[model samples]
Target: MKRTLVIGDIHGGLKGLQQVLKRAKISEKDKLIFVGDYVDGWSDNASTIDFLIKISEKNNCIFIRGNHDYLLHKYLTKNDTNPMWVNHGGASSIKSYEHISEEKKQRHILFLDHLKNYYIDSENRLFVHAGFTNQNGIGNEFNPDMVYWDRTLWEMVCVMDPSSSKNNELYPKRLKNYSEIFIGHTPTTRIGKSTPQNFANVWNVDTGAAFKGCISVMDIVTKDFWQSDPVWRLYPDEKGRN
Candidate 1:
């Protein structure tokens, strides 16, 4: 049987990403859904993109756009080296491209440019980099930028009454539109977790690979997950997104 896997924020930890894939025993038959933040934080920003692009060519993959990814794309294509971005992981990403050929850099740019803001699978499961604010759901989202930048959806679900039924009046209409929602951006580590976290019908897969935590991948249907060693251990010499 084919497995559908949902991956969390990578944050340029190519080692973590590779470890998880090996642990997961990934095959061509498996479908990979990446929740983004593929670049920035660690030193392998360019190398990570190269690996992703190469793997995508041979395996089924859906890549979502993350806020950091947008920043990287802006820096690459428009020269918008925003200071805030630089202070928060963008500096590493910028440095990673310093030695790349212009042609390869352009290919990476195209890859970032084409990342999806959000994706809804055949199972009516929504996969997005962050969260959407549209109470009516992603289809009715007004701000395209908000889809990958909003934290309201995650914040809402995180505090929801887990026992509340869907029929409850307080249940969020946005979540009701989909069977389940998978998101990254806000790391589970914030809540003292280094594993995939589920609250209500939404799952937060970002285990903080950008920081001290590990990278995680989950079999969405089975709820079985695999994680790499802590990213800080993977790159002991660098302070990744700390």
Candidate 2:
């Protein structure tokens, strides 16, 4: 049977991504859901996006838009000169595109432009790069920034008791709409977890692939998972979160 695999923030750790995919035994038959952050950390932002574009053409794939991705989009489309973006690895992403052909750069911009904020699978599993805060549910009227940057949902999940009777009261109606939700903005390592971390009905899959952690891939149905070696090891000479 084919599996639905959800991967975490990539942060341009292309080699680490390869390792995790191999460890997960990924096949074309599998459906891959990437909780984004595809660019902006290691050195291969362009290559990482390129690989994702290629694989997406031949396999079942869902790419969620991440904050870094949105920043890049904003920069490309509006020439957004936010220093915050530049301070947080955006310069590295920009540097990655310096030598690429304009054609490929345009393709990457288009790819970013077309990315979805979230996806709901047949089983009602939510896949997003970050959390949504709209009390009305994941509708089109919601904030794009929230979809790619919110950490409150994860914070709620971390503190709420999943088995508690107050679960209903503790969760917003929008969040309650899914059986499970997968996200990848905040790294598990930020909370001292080096692997995919599960809290209540939310799963945080970003194991800090941009920094000292690794990439993670989880079987959406079974919850079984695979992880790559520490990504920093793969890029021994680069400073990641700059």
Candidate 3:
């Protein structure tokens, strides 16, 4: 049966991405939703983007904009040389782009330019790079930056008791109208795990592929997931996000 595979932040781990897809045994009919951060950290940023673009041509793919992706797009289009972006893995992306053809670079820029901040599937699952603020529900206005950079949504879930009396006061106010929410920006590794985590109806799938962990992909419906080899192992010769 066809399934929706919501992928986590890739961070230029091409081999990791390939491995996860292979493990998932993805078919042409399956829908692929990438949470975000397709570039930076690893050495194969350009190749990773190329692979994603090529895969989109053959399968159902939805690319969501990540904070890294946004920074890269800004750099490409406006020559943004923000140190924070560069220090936080953007340099690797720049190096990768320098080796590619100008035409390909332009195409990549366009690809990044068109990324969506969030996506709501037919099942009402909200797929976003980070989190969105919604007091009332889905119809509430959201800040795009928050949608791609917020951590409070997950933070609240981590601290507040799911069974606490506060559940009614917090959940409805923080989460929008979505059955489930899948996000990537904050790696689960920070919490000392290299696997997807679940809390208060939110799933964090970024297993730190850009650093020492592996890339991850989750089945939106079944919640089953797959991972690649440790990301640093994929490129032993390079200092990945060290």
Candidate 4:
């Protein structure tokens, strides 16, 4: 089987991402799949995008659109009408592009626009930025709002209680889509925690890398995981927590 490495939200931590990749020992023959949020938050959004673009051109790479990515694309394409965009890390993403030439900015926007919302491999593994919705039946087109903004799915899947299993039945078995769904956007305290119900094979790889944590990478086939130690520690909020 071809080894597939699925990366969580990068959040513009290029050095952290590099360390994760190096520790994971990614090889040229392996497929690299990004769950999105490549740019925004920390810094080096331009370099992050440029590096991913180069890797996509040279190797097998799948890029999915995260909420932040969608917001970034909106600003780049529509000149920023969405206020929610700014509140959700879009400001930093825009600042990342400020030093780039207009031509390059347009190129980046075009690239973001072309990214698919999800990717499914032949092995029945589904990869999406956020969780999918089952409203109006399953296999329906992914709702953009849910894709970019919904936290219900994470709540439904991430709770650590046996009762949470009941929530899994909300989606009809017919709509139980993929054998496994790889996702990002929800920052778990740990990486690759299975959903409350065993019915959905969900892997959440976002380890809060932007908030004094580490970036994570997981091998789909082997279930092996790797992460970097926090390289940049920012002061915590008034709550004194990330």
Compute each candidate's TM-score over C-alphas.
0.98, 0.94, 0.94, 0.82
Superior by TM-score: candidate 1 or candidate 2: 1
Give each prediction's root-mean-square deviation over alpha carbons: 0.7, 1.7, 1.7, 4.4
lDDT (0 to 1) per candidate: 0.93, 0.87, 0.87, 0.71
Error of 2 at 226 (Å): 0.7
The all-Cα superposition gives candidate 4 an RMSD in Å to the true structure of 4.4
Residue 43 in candidate 3, Cα distance off native in Å:
0.8
**Please, what are the lDDT tens digits per residue for candidate 2 over residues 76-107?**
77878699988888888888877989798889
lDDT of 3 at 17: 96
The window of 10 residues in a row where model 1 has the poorest summed lDDT is 133-142
| Clash count for each candidate, listed in order shown | 0, 0, 0, 0
Candidate 1 residue runs with Cα over 4 Å from true position:
none
Residue range 1-242, candidate 3, lDDT tens digits: 89899999999999999999999999999999999999999988989889999999999999999999999999888989899999999999889888788899899988998899888888788888888666664346455577788887777777766775434655455554677889999989999998999987889999999889999999988899999999899899988786
**Comparing 1 and 3 on TM-score, the stronger one:** 1
Q: TM-score of model 4 relative to the true fold?
A: 0.82
TM-score: which candidate is best? 1
